[model samples]
Target: MTDQLPPQPTTPPPPAEPPAEPLVAPTAELAKRQLTPLAAGVLGLAIGAAVVGGAWLVTATTGPSEPATFTLKGTFALTDSVYTDPGDDSCRGSADSGYDDIAEGTSVTVYGAEGDVIATGSLGQSNSDETGTACTYKIAVPDVPSGEKFYKVEVSHRGTVQLTAEEAENGELAASLG
Candidate 1:
């Protein structure tokens, strides 16, 4: 059994590799192999077309946002003094922009700070034909209060321009009395 012990085996080594040569010669030779002008032009056109076609496909599959739909809502108030005649006393009232466009022959009423119908006017179709960002109405507040009084203006619209008071009690309203 001792004599049967196997001798250690050794495998032959792999073959040695050849030394590497610089790639400069092969690269230069490849560069020297040039295509004809016509072939080069055709190849350039094909590359350009491929790029353009790819871009077109990408664009065609995608869509742009819909044109924005927006609107503006607002209201304003104004107070003006009016005298029956040059020598008559002036009365106080207000004009506001927030009524259903009253049609000709339509009856309209405006309330004062106390909710009293301060003005009772009729809508005239004569000026109803106009429309745009601004509108004007020939309002006739047929009767004016008989004594010295205060006036208030109120305006309202959508969320854009909600109701607001126009008077500056600290004498802002009187500043325009003259």
Candidate 2:
């Protein structure tokens, strides 16, 4: 038998080394490079100004709004024997009756405070009194602008009848051409 080699003391291999750190900076170190307070405030103000300016531009470019409007209603009466209704929807004035200009389907105009024609309509069917001595025509001018200090109504070029806003709106205007 070969002589056995002298026994030598055995030792475990060195423990494996831990992994190396990455090249990038840690999270806490990167947070320190964030924007300063003043820079952040300036950015916020710029955003706010842009928003306000955009709104202002939109409002300025828009066209003016339309005015409010209402229907003006009243009556136009011809209280003269010369105006006669022949059992028809219309009434006719005799020639040389002085009120010959006034008739059924005549133009009725509403004027604004500045003398602008705001609305125009025509006289409706005529209604005769039992005595046949008078004829009344309904006046309706639609889409008359409101907020005027006063209104003027004209019937078939007959002189205008002045009315306050309240009077015009309340249908208190009654014009007669005899």
Give each prediction's root-mean-square deviation over alpha carbons: 19.2, 10.8
lDDT of each: 0.38, 0.84
Tell me the spans in candidate 1 whose CA falls farther than 4 Å from its real position: 1-35, 60-67, 73-75, 80-160, 163-178
Model 1 agreement with the true structure over 68-96: per-residue lDDT tens digits? 22111121222232211124222222224
lDDT of 2 at 34: 83
* TM-scores for candidates 1 onward, in order: 0.24, 0.62
lDDT of 2 at 124: 77
Model 1 scores worst on lDDT over the 10 consecutive residues at: 155-164
| Residue-wise C-alpha lDDT for candidate 2, range 1-178, written one tens digit per residue | 7799888869878999998977998999998888889999999999999999999999888958878888898888888755565656456565677777777788898898999998898887787777777788888788888899999998887789999999999988798877
